[model samples]
Target chain A: MVTLKQIRNSVLIALWMMILTFPIMVIKVNTIENIVIWRWMNLLYIGVGTVILSIFWFFLINRRKLEPEERKRSFALKGKIETLKGVLAKPVVQKPLYAALLVIIIIFPFVSSLYQTGIMITALMYVILGLGLNIVVGLGGLLHLGYAAFYAVGAYTYALLHRYLGLSFWVCLPIGALSAMLLGILVGLPVLRLRGDYLAIVTLAFGEIVRILLENLSQYTGGPAGISGIPRPSFFGIKMSLSTAMNYTYFLTFALVLFTIFVVRRLEHSRLGRSWVAMREDEVASEAMGIDITRAKLSSFALGALWAGLAGVFFSAKTTFVNPASFTLWESVIILCVVVLGGIGSIKGVVLGAIVIILLPEYLRAFSQYRMLFFGLILVMMMIFRPGGFIPAKRRVYTFDKAQLEESD
Target chain B: MAAILDASQVTMDFGGLRAVNNADVHIDQGEIVALIGPNGAGKTTFFNVITGVYKPTTGDVRITAPGKETESITGLKPNKITEKGLARTFQNIRLFQNMTVLENVMIGRHCRMKAGIAGAVFRDRKTREEEEQVVADSYAILKKIGLETFVNELAKNLPYGAQRRLEIARAMATEPFLLLLDEPAAGMNPHETRELDEMILKIRATEKISILLIEHDMSLVMSISDRIYVMDYGLLIAEGQPKEVRANPAVIKAYLGEEFNA
Candidate 1:
């Protein structure tokens, strides 16, 4: 039986939720009549629903608090979840799962509509950006708040090159990436000594400076009006229409994503990768273990920017336009959220995060006005409940038998 | 015997306070030296100075490798100093908590191995072979340290004693000619301390690496150290063979205290 205090608490929670949801749900606009209307029925529905949900939660929480048996049951549930995770992580299960995912991704464009294909391209672009940022933030333990600046550098590099010099997309790809890398080095050199929040603020300021320069340099960058009529990449001199253009961009991005996965996977197991992990865990100990902090920090910045540059090239080619507004602080925050919400260091997690964050808002278009609010609410809830992400990165393990060591010797 | 590490007249001042003042210390090839003093004696500060964590305000630290010329390594970066064949373990165990035990050791092999971004990303045959070697060598070190059983476990998950051993194993993987240990037995039980003593001896014998440890445990210091240096107020008070250091009045008054002499 629920106590008097439990009932009161549930009621208070219901009242609080009502106050919060009233503005969005109960308030409505009659555009045709040009009048504001208070939808009382909606308020009643929310109040009733909240009261029921709160009472259920109170019972669940109070039972665990009052009974050792309930607490034990919860512990058992957690143990089962851990066991399930272990079982899923085994090679026998993982190999098949990976194969299935590969097959699904390969066939996605063919099965989906043209609009969906466009969305997939956008998601893949964020995936590349997320993976790049993961190296600096997740692996190197650097907080970068202005990562979108590199993306801008990549996009603008392609836009300006094509507009002035008439450079082809294939020719400009590497050049764009190189420019970003150089900028990364330039920015990293001055701020490599700062750690944690200080580094983040500096990077944020750097990002803003890049955007403002792009805006004010109207003669060179086209300023706030942005550059238009940027040409789409052609397939071996084949002129493309709208439908074929969508497919072309999809395949291009797909190939890039696969290459990214391969590079990131190899780097994760390499000597350099291990050094990054060490530096992230403990900088002082890492230095004592002979990791050159300066080299490692600089390399992380350069390499992370490399992928962003590539993605930026694709973003321009896909849209056939470049704008200062496209590369904003919000863009950086979203990409960061994709990295963190998926699983910071996990490639699969980042991919999943990019897809979810990108696609969920698109699907919630029926609630167009409230989509961002809903997205914000979901993100806050995800942070509160699963801070490690939807899929946390797995730790690497090595096992060797005594006989193996002897044989190697 | 050649002096592997020779820090002469080293001084470090933070504002008005002198942390390490006119400190001179040296470790001979294959010798096990101990630096002992009371709390706040600047033993760690001296270790940091030698390891290139801090540039000394005055004086130079010279390292002479076997059959090589003595090189003044003062003001070099810590990693550069480590690459010059001097490595150290922290007084507080600092393992890469999230990484596996083998990975921790593999990181120590970082300076020895040469693989840039291109090699790491592309996985050339040579890079692959080098990585395999690193793994094999790290596993071998773990076996010697008796932590092979926990090789796959996260560094944070290891027992306190094993974490301490892992730190040593990591330092050894750097292929240092001289290993500086900062209070390695700080939180160890008697049994763990004894195991550490034996391990240190084994490392010295097998790896041929000289050891310079700052230890507060008197019994362990007395039993294992070939030579002892006593420090107080950032200055070396006495230096001699263990017996002489034990009997020295200056060391007794400053570190061991009057009761120990009695």
Candidate 2:
């Protein structure tokens, strides 16, 4: 059943893979002596490996083609798969799945190493930031390229307040968030009228301005050196050690992520949320529908800034350091990437996007210099295959049958 | 009958090119008036001026709400004009294409509903009750327009005629005292136009809402409209009962080579 044409195609694929890997496998740099060396054994191993992999792949693909009953079997298999999916999707099954996930997350830090916990904390911080940006870009359809400016404002607000006024983390949290919200409004007012690329450019400039101001105002902020020795958030007046502080901050960010999810979920289903969707779909028509476009845009900006502010406070407490270099245009771009890579309007997608974007780079550290190249390749692949993100938002569904049943009058 | 909308000396000049020149139009309570003209007669431009889409170069647009004093609404925002009980539909159907039919109507009730961000996030009892009321009211409006069957369908998925009706249903959700419709029967077939005529009459009779429409469908206008105003080159040339306007020489000249048999 293995056709001559199929075998030829597999051989060609094997040849391509061998050619692609030849340079990497056959040549090596002698870092210590600065000399080039040839590795014929490695090249041979790669060529053999590609040949074996292609043979296996072709065998799997050709097996179904060989069996005439495979088509009918697959149709039946698909039906069974759908039934299994329905069962798994039932509320009874889902409730337990959620509970199990919660239990695992609670015990994860205790079981995992300290380094793993640190990585998790970073991922969770991005999750909060991603959710905040999702409100503006995803729901409100406003492209903000300078979201990290608000993040910086929040971090510095807490840093300066604790440094000058001797305020505790608990006291600085609200003030830092409010300050960021105020700045969000101030920056949002004039630029809200501009649409698309123009709005994006103005916001990009605003972010750079904040960074330059922070750097030049070194008498207060420490310039490139940054402020260090910022106090950790104490738990019930007890000072935490390095490991304990990691766990505490992890739990704190976990709770905040849950809160963000809850608030965003509610907003998505509420009147305000609907108005945001309306604005996203058609701005002029939304205004004619009696929605105050100015109010909606401003509120989205403030709310988005509020979350970023909270995340900034947590960032300062965890690192116990702050600097202008820490908040950059790159930071804003990475956070935006997370939101876009996650489905823009979906809460779950944003969370998954944050985890993938934050964790994948760390895991690829073994490749060191090649990790960024690999990351770029993966992102390109994902964009080509799943442009809607890891988890796309669900389309709206209405049950007219139920309404008809109830409308007997 | 008391005038629900009164506009005097309304002129709109877009940098030396006059779109509407000194056009005076009015709608009385519960009256169905048709603004019929050939293409580019400033009928829609005049409507935009009244609905606050554009501020006329020189004009005063006043709305007299039932039992309320008349007030100038010339420079107000479109949302503000909607709040003052005047709502208009676009010539092209402007329903939110991605949203459900029910949601499109519920959005029309936005000005009437009072739930803000805090209320929405907290889910207070009052907000919950108001939200329920909005759903019920929106459903009733859909049913009135015979669109209850497609309540869950996206606006883009509906047929052309249904999309047009959905626009009117959405405008009515604001509970306007006067509805301004720009070419409601533009692409409708004869059967659909007949249904639209009956629906417009029913809206006027049951809701007591005045209708001012810009239409090219002569049969629809002649059959349903109580009065007609003919516009030509930004000027109001004739205004009278439908029969008189149809026979007027100025109206005939304005509609020269256009169909007016209906």
Candidate 3:
């Protein structure tokens, strides 16, 4: 029901907007011709557009959004996802669906442009990074702003090893991850006592410190120039074209994303995961519950860093270069956004978050100028209306397969 | 009877103030001990000192797990103390709000379970079996405590009484030889308090776990505690069996006013 008052309010907002833009949008000066013209039609368009938009926003769109129905609906991604999960959770649907999805992804490079596959590989890499950040920020409840420090560590390990010792990507992968894990443990040790705001500050400092070190240590890390001409990972000493290599990286990244999902999912349901959630929930209570919080926290940091490290190596391999410019505070922020834009602690949410945050922007190159504007708008709208991100992570629910009758202790 | 938990001359001085001064508390095998006091009595500080949340400024706490010798738990972290069979709940109900009721209990089994990062990721048969057993054990505890219905519910979503009961269930999951419950019945109604009483008694009978509780509910404390300790102004005013503690002049004076005693 659009009342007269609503229409008046909408018109008043439109008038305010038109007045704000009157100088630039409505008035034109032609000094050379010695003529001044008022673009009354432009003003009319502004008035009509603002009124329509405001009416649509206040009455039509926003009314459905901040209304009383939301709580009953909750922070849900909505009925489509709920219905999708119902349809998808069943083995009859899921198994074949998974197989079909895999087949399509495997054959995607053949059917689609190499550029699309490359973009997908980038997206999948972020999926891995998003899942990694999800562990620290999402599950462990550690706000790690220096997460990319480990990514830098991973990238540097592979790059420097290749540049100096000439180690292969396959050999450098685990070493790169281990180097990050070691750094994670090292980082976790000093920051163990800190919590909340202090922790965020410390981790942020850690990230900057790593970047500065890489920049300043020009002799070792090639300073800002960075190491270039790094080779793509090979499959069993076989030579392949750039196109073939891109597809292979895509396949490899896709497989690893699956592995990360499996490992993280299993971890979430396991004892360590429970303790991590417990620690996240209440540190003092978790301590009283007999969790070695120091060990638990360090484990999460190590695991989260390990994934970031894996992503970093994949990144260095994918780009075939290493530079301080590529790794900045912004890199960490982007990964953080992926986890937050996906529901924190939700695996599928993180995956979707990575895809949306990474892939869509690449395809929308025409509106590339407005990408950050759109990003800011979407984030603001998400934070205001649906703060739980696309898909909120659910707590693990347990059920018994059968009733227990055997009892003698 | 063997004393399962003993804290001697525990004085906690916070800067210029002595929150708890030379307070000694001991709980024996299968005994229900109660610590009662006025609001600023340092009962919680004493509890904290004993549970290793705060190390005492002057004294030491010792716990003897079943089949184990008495060992000093002082200077150890709370997790270490809990591993030694002394588990405590917070007075303010510090449950894992987002975690399910069962997971809340399962966390209690942390010290007992030995799975590492590798075990969690790869999930060998042993790890899987241990996890399943933990789930079963945790559910059994919830069932025993009548929180089975809310087993899958988040800890925050449980009602006031159930939250209190869930605290006890979680503490029990640690398999503590001596369970320290800080105000387990604080917000409970008479009916809920009655159930708590029955639950505590049942826990003692079935699990052979000794209990020490800090409560302001005088009737419940008087009715259930085999022994009682009273504190006032951070001093141990009196300690005895419930009858003796009830009639003690200091206990009465602490509860009533100085004028009433006069």
Candidate 4:
């Protein structure tokens, strides 16, 4: 009930209707200009606009938020049931949904022929990273600002392997993943005892350190100039090199997306996932309940790193370039924003956030020079208005009667 | 009576103060023993030291079970102590407020559940079977404690008396041979206290689990505990059956007060 998707669709329809009818307004404006003098119409228009603006502003400012809103009440009941059953059922019902979504995703770019295909691929990558981070951040409740470090490590590993060893992309992928995980564990050891903000700040420092090393090690990483002309992957020796476009890359992206989804889905339903949540919720109690906090946190960090590394492999392959610029703190922040803007532990919400965060800016290209400003303002407004998320994780409700029990007690 | 737990020359100092000093305690099998003391008498401090929250500056606490299972509980973590047939409730109730009553009890069974992450995540046949057994056993404990209905309710949402019972229920779920109850009747009214007295007696008789209770309610303590130990200024002043300890001059002076003796 009152889903964000429905709201988006409705808003799109309203905007379209306004645009379609704009010509009629243009004709009326011309007729009015002819009927009145040009100077007087301009003055009249300004005066009328001021009055309309004032009135609209007054209503908006003075509007009373009704105590018992009908829309909210209608949604609340629906929301409770959905959260209890639908959200809980996600892991259980993933198969059919995954199959349907897989078919749609595989063919989506061909059907739309839109630049949004790129956005989808990017979102899918972020979803993979978020799932990994969910293990570290959401489950373990550890703040990891250096997740991009793992991504960079993965990208570099793939680049080096392909460049020097002439290793196949298939062979290098697992190597990249392992490299990232090893780095994750290395980062984890020093800060395993830290908690909350301290852990975050340390990780943030680690990320910066990695970036600086990549920049300073000019001979190894090619420094600020970066590594270029990385090989494009071929499926059965058929590369998309002749197409002058991104056909093979798209398929590669789709396969990666499927793989990410499968891994994340399995991990979420795993015991490690529960342990992370348990640690996050109550560390002392979790320990008392026989869950090992240290192992849980490390596992979360490593899993998160593994996902980032995998994404980096694809990201480097798609771009055919590795640079310090691509793995900046801002990239980490944007990925974090995508996770946060989607609900942190919520898979669907994160995916939706990634799509919107990426596509909304692209769609605003008609605004030309103001595109970035408009995008920034939209992000601010969305955060202010719906901090829980555009699509918040459904909250579970439980009800049980205890009158007889009280009497007995 | 065979001693299940023996504390020898236990002494704990906190910066400038001696919380528990030169203390000796022996808890025999199949007996309910009460550790009674005045407000500043350090009964809780002794319990904490024994439970390994604070390692005693000098002392050894030994728990000897059947088959010569002897565990020196000193310097071990609270959970470790709990694992060795000793579970404790806090002086100020420390139930996980957000968790359901059933879940809180299930947490006690955490140590018992042999299924690791793989088993739980997959809900494999063994995990499912273990979960079923835990649920069944937890329900039985809840029923025994008369909190079966409030099983799904959040622990914090329960009425005060019920919350106290839930605390006991949670400790029982740990399957401890010796339950350390910190002020079980602390805030209860007369009726609730009476009910608790009967409940403690019933647990003693049926479960055959010895109880070590720290209580301020003298009436309940005198009526239930097979033996009582009174403390003042971190020293054991008196120890015996209720009537003898009640009449002891030192206990009267330290805890009961001169007015009660008069």
Instruction: Estimate every model's Cα lDDT from 0 to 1.
Output: 0.90, 0.89, 0.89, 0.75
| Pairs of residues clashing in candidate 3 | none
lDDT by residue (tens digit), candidate 1, A204-276: 9999999999999999999999999888877898888887888888889989998998998888888887777
Q: Cα deviation of B74 in candidate 1 (Å)? A: 0.6
Candidate 3 lDDT, A1-409, residue by residue in tens: 4568888999999999899999999789999998888998998999999999878666544445555566336536565666787998899998999899889888888888988888889899999999998988899999989888999999999999999999999999999999999999998999978998899999999999999999999999899999998889989989999999998898889999999999999999888898889999999999999998998899999999999899889989999999998789999999999999989999989999999899767866779799778778878777665678888899877765554523411
lDDT of 3 at A140: 91
Better of 2 and 3 by TM-score: 3
lDDT at A76 for candidate 1? 75
What DockQ does each prediction reach against the true complex?
Answer: 0.71, 0.49, 0.70, 0.19
Task: Assess candidate 4 and give its lDDT.
Answer: 0.75
Classified by CAPRI criteria, candidate 2 counts as: acceptable
For residues A122-218, what per-residue lDDT tens digits would candidate 2 score against the true structure?
Answer: 8999999999999998889899999999999989988999899999888988998899999999999998999989989999999999999999999
Best by lDDT: 1
Segments of candidate 1 deviating more than 4 angstroms: A1-8, A15-48, A54-100, A401-403, B256-262
Instruction: Kindly list the per-residue Cα lDDT of model 4 for residues A18-104, writing each as its tens digit.
Output: 455444433343475566223434444544554454454343333323233543354577457656777657876777877887788
Q: What is the Å distance of residue B140 in model 4 from its true position? A: 4.3
Error of 3 at A78 (Å): 7.9
Q: Alpha-carbon error at A256 in model 1, in Å? A: 0.3
Q: Lowest-lDDT window of 10 residues in candidate 2 chain B?
A: B253-262
Native interface contact recovery, all models: 0.90, 0.62, 0.87, 0.19
Query: Model 1 chain B, poorest ten-residue lDDT window?
Result: B253-262
Q: What 10-residue stretch in candidate 2 chain A is worst by lDDT? A: A400-409
TM-score of chain B of each: 0.97, 0.97, 0.97, 0.95
Please list the residue runs of candidate 4 whose C-alpha ends up more than 4 Å from where it truly belongs after superposition: A1-103, A232-234, A241-271, A364-409, B38-45, B66-68, B97-99, B117-124, B131-147, B150-163, B185-199, B230-237, B248-262
